[model samples]
Target: MKQQKGFTLIELAIVLAIIGIILGAILKGQELINNAKAKRLLNDVKGWATLEYTFYDRYGRFAGDGDGDGLIDAGAFATSQANFGANYIPPTSALLTPTTAYQNSDFDAPVATLEAAQLLPAAQNAPQRRTNVTNAFNGITYPASVYIDNVGTFNVIAVKNIPCFAAKVIDSNIDGSIGANVGYVREIDNTGALTGNNTWSCDANNNEQQLVSLVYFFDKRPN
Candidate 1:
């Protein structure tokens, strides 16, 4: 009877090496994608701040902050997971004829105000931004709701539903600290309340859990 030969030792070693190289490439590609996502989150925060300031400069008041109280009086984001639903676009009329103010203001007013004035590009609309990021576990997209509350002692533009891992990357880049509970950038509960300056989980392994909404405080003009 002829003996059957399995994979030769050298052939097996070469195959294993090729497999390792392929896996390394895949992981590296994923890392780059994650890094790009983190950059987008950071840029969105900065760009939103710039928009608020630019609106303040042009109109002498912040958009969505109709009361001149220097806070974004978001009617939509009055509570957790409030209006500005996944597809909520402020009226086309509002978009086309936006004033520095609105009759019934909400998160919509800010984007509407800026859009009408041509300060914000059409791409900056809520629906567009809402799709930019997502809840990692369930794949739900979180809109970048412009609002202010007791996210801290000051006002903030609530960047919602950032998974813990990305949040850590962003917080570290902005605040120079690695935790989620303090700094101009804070990790807030889904209820949109600040529980005070303390640490929260930055578990490297919690990559897909939409752990918190990050509120970055801004110097909205004082009343």
Candidate 2:
């Protein structure tokens, strides 16, 4: 209180304005970061899809389905050793095989197979394979798996832990809306039903803003 030199009304206003600007800048920067992360995630998915096609084109079979039986060839089903590396073993069962036809779970065998075939980078083992793979933007781990739907279509499923993050990916790549016409479908959780969650819908009513756990199925044909 030696000077009691409180800022005048004008000074206070200026200070407040400066603070607002700084906050705005910080927020904008965060937004740009988020956008970049979303873009990277989308690119990774696309890259995987492309690799699936390339693998099929070169090997005449999908990556995880070594036998081309339209089922995930893993565990005892795997007949051939993964050629991507020396110690990598190909998945002998479907990593994307849902426990109850709806709930999704983490699988790394497909990734290992891809690595083994030189389609994806090789890892030391299954756990290492999974730990090494992560989303570039958010550092979120990706659960990569392959499976054949009942319709006989080969699918590569990539799991994202965050629903909103997945939404950003779908919006950036396919369509911004999480509703119909979107390239990817939304599911509540790995085990949850595949559809019927209106709240998570990116429809006009929902705005596709809500966040939940999501699994993305990238389908491809085994030619």
CA lDDT scores, all candidates in order: 0.57, 0.49
What value does the lDDT take at residue 112 in candidate 2? 60
So what's the TM-score on candidate 1?
0.73
Which candidate leads the pack in lDDT?
1
Best by TM-score: 1
Error of 1 at 21 (Å): 1.4
Q: For candidate 2, write residues 1-223 as lDDT tens digits.
A: 4867789999999999999999999999977877786676677766776776676676665555544554444322121112212344454333223221211222345566566567665566644554445565333333234333454433544434443655656544564464422346444344333444543554435543444444455553222
RMSD of each: 5.0, 7.9
Measured with C-alpha atoms, the lDDT of residue 80 in candidate 1 is 37
Error of 2 at 57 (Å): 0.7
Error of 1 at 145 (Å): 9.4
